[model samples]
Target: MTSKPAIGIFLSIALAASALWFWQTQTVRPAPAVSFKTIKGNSLELASLKGRPVIVSFWATDCPGCIEEIPHLISLHQQYKSSGLAIIAVSMYYDPPNHVLAIADSKQLPYEVALDPSGTLAQAFGNVQLTPTTFLIDKSGHIILQKVGVFELSDMQQRIEQL
Candidate 1:
């Protein structure tokens, strides 16, 4: 019973609504403001790295998956540092700071290594309850991706290249 003009108006409204919904859902969000102290007593702040892409990794010393990702992260850091990529590996609260420090030293980790003794960093990042959870924040501070486990090197590289 609707006239042609009325049908066109309805369709236009629906299309506009759909486009708004898509934009709201697809837009990346800014990373949470969190800070941590590196094992060597250096301060690292998420907000401070706004102009560079950052990879924030939550890990524990005893986690097998976490251990598995270290080399890949190190390699990624080495490969992307010149391209303005910063990686911060934050040890979980359950991990003793000394252990984290020793491992960082032994492995000669070139990137910043931090200790989350109170788990504040993890809690801020959506109560991250799993080891190996990683957030890839783009140069503008928006969270480009979040991975719950080991990050595939190739996939991560492709994502980074896009940023």
Candidate 2:
């Protein structure tokens, strides 16, 4: 049988290992390179936005959460454009181009809207499989935050303010 002190030390080591693993998973890394055409037929490359903070949001028209987040994104774009914040909304492969275009037009989205029909863009961004998966990239083109699902507007604002 193990002594009491030995058991306690083992447990502490295991706990420390688990915490290290979790922290590594949560830490943001470099944003992947991606090039795609926007709804307006303009060529947009991730590298082009290197000098500005960019929010690359993967969304689809049929996703309620994605739809709900658009207004907040638009507001962010308006408030931060002058400060060099660029927002790029990328529609998923399953979403039809026409549907994406229609929604973009209706919403009057004030940022670049692109379609990832081949799933290349999604794969580049860590195989993003869920709608509303968003990445906040810093001016140096490194990902600072990767959030799945709806993100709180106030929290996002605070993060941007720091960048």
Candidate 3:
């Protein structure tokens, strides 16, 4: 008769093997271009944002993570703008234009924020459910990173530095 220990070992080995297989097959991915109108009431082009690293940060007014990271994003903008880092703060829910302006001002966020007036663009890009999701597009406009939730300021800077 087999002992329970043998079964446990077999299960553990199987789990490990499957986990490894899954890890090798799947990873974070970038998105193809999706369209949206600009808050300025003009045609904002996604193509224009290519050939550099663009951070499309998805947020809603009520998300604490969204609110907390504005300052970090502001720093990222200031630090990396001249170095080809483009940050587009995309709102997942519509707030009044004036309110957005005020929050941006208070946070000292000088980056370009295109309001997703209906939050549809968030779905169009990727991961519609996650607030404060940051998509990092590489020099060729292919997505290289999609970070859900708040991330360290230094980590963002480090990645940009490498780029």
Candidate 4:
């Protein structure tokens, strides 16, 4: 009957939708193995930070969104640093080291701020071409979230806590 055929089609659509949702939710990538040299003259190897949640943010000093997210990033570092959460804010290659250092000092940022003058850091992180791009890697070194522009603080906090 027509009613039976309609019901079958609806079930098929529902099943396909569920499959797509499952696939999307499970798509997580491993973080790239990269090293960072912070403005404070410290070296950090991404592989060494395994078993800890890490936030690798690519930003520029001139980006308004990046500037706007600074406070939130600072808050997160303060809240979670004691709990094995590491945050590295890498300035874009085009941003001069002096400018990055000036901004970091002016803001009194408590976390690591690195300069990417050669763009190797950006290239390691998916060839990052945009400012205010952030990747949240879990304790297992798998990137669970990649967001461009400003991210929701609550959502990021929740994810970090979950990790």
Candidate 5:
């Protein structure tokens, strides 16, 4: 049989861990104001990107679904940038500033990315359950589209053009 002290210690540890997870999960976070800095120190503000339609992709490095959709996102970012579209990839995992930059560099991605390793920003946008959740915002900053499953970037572009 276990000693009483041992059982108490185990319970304490479990409760502490549970509380930490709860705190992390339950807290609310609001969307940031127009701009915020990327982990790498580049100035990033939603307001500065206002003239263009915005695409915010919530992804994680290790998620297969997220990785699979990256090329599509890249295509969207490239094709629409000139048309006043801005794509901001908000990574959910392995989100050090350097990690975000490395992916951008390797892919030769021209748009911007911001990290939210702890899900603060993700929560702000009401995107918490899955990776690769994408939001397409109109130039006026309204969330015009949202995709939770795998989707084609071209299809999104076609829809935007129609808007």
Candidate 6:
């Protein structure tokens, strides 16, 4: 049988290994190199927004959660746009272009809205197939936070403020 001290040493090693793994997984990674074609026919590149905080949100018009988050995103944009925050709402390729345009128009969205017709953008961003997947990128173009669903508004605001 293993002695008590031996077991304790093993447990300590396991805990240290787990902590190291967590730290490596949580390390921030650089954002994907991608460009967006806005609904308004303007072209923008992610690299060009290097010196500002950016939110790249992948969403679909038919997604309930995506629709639910629009107001909050609009509020964030309005609150931070003047402070050098950039937000881009990217509609999934599966979403019809007409629907995307209608929603953007009806909501009077103040941020950039782009369409992913070929689905290349989704594939580039870590094969993002789920709706409402949001990435908060810091000024250096590193992805600081990635959320698969609706994010906590307070936490998001705090992170953005700190960036």
Candidate 5 backbone collisions, by pair: 34-45, 34-46, 34-47, 35-45, 35-46, 36-44
List per-prediction Cα lDDT, in the order shown: 0.87, 0.89, 0.74, 0.90, 0.70, 0.90
lDDT of 4: 0.90
lDDT digits (tens) for residues 1-163 of candidate 2: 5699899999999999887655433547888887978999999888988989999999999999999999999999999999999999999999999999999999999999998889999999988998899888988988988888888899889989988
At residue 4, give the lDDT of candidate 5: 92
Best by lDDT: 6
Q: How does residue 12 of candidate 3 score in lDDT? A: 99
Q: How much is 123 displaced in model 4, in angstroms?
A: 1.0
Off by over 4 Å in 4: 1-27
lDDT of 1: 0.87
Better of 1 and 2 by TM-score: 2
Query: Residue by residue across 1-163, what tens digits does model 4's lDDT show?
Result: 8999999999999999887655434538988988899998989999999999999999999999999999999999999999999999999999988889899999999988988889999998778898898888999999887777788899889989998
Clashes, model 2: 0
TM-scores for the candidates: 0.82, 0.84, 0.75, 0.83, 0.70, 0.84
Error of 1 at 153 (Å): 0.3
Error of 3 at 15 (Å): 7.8
Local accuracy of candidate 5 as per-residue lDDT tens digits, 72-152: 877877777678777787887455667667777887766677777666677777745677777777666666666676667
Q: For candidate 3, give the lDDT.
A: 0.74
Please report the TM-score between candidate 6 and the true structure.
0.84
Candidate 5 TM-score versus the reference: 0.70
Candidate 1 lDDT for residue 26:
47
lDDT of 6 by residue, 43-90 (tens): 999999999999999999989999999988998998999999999999
Q: Indicate the TM-score of model 3.
A: 0.75
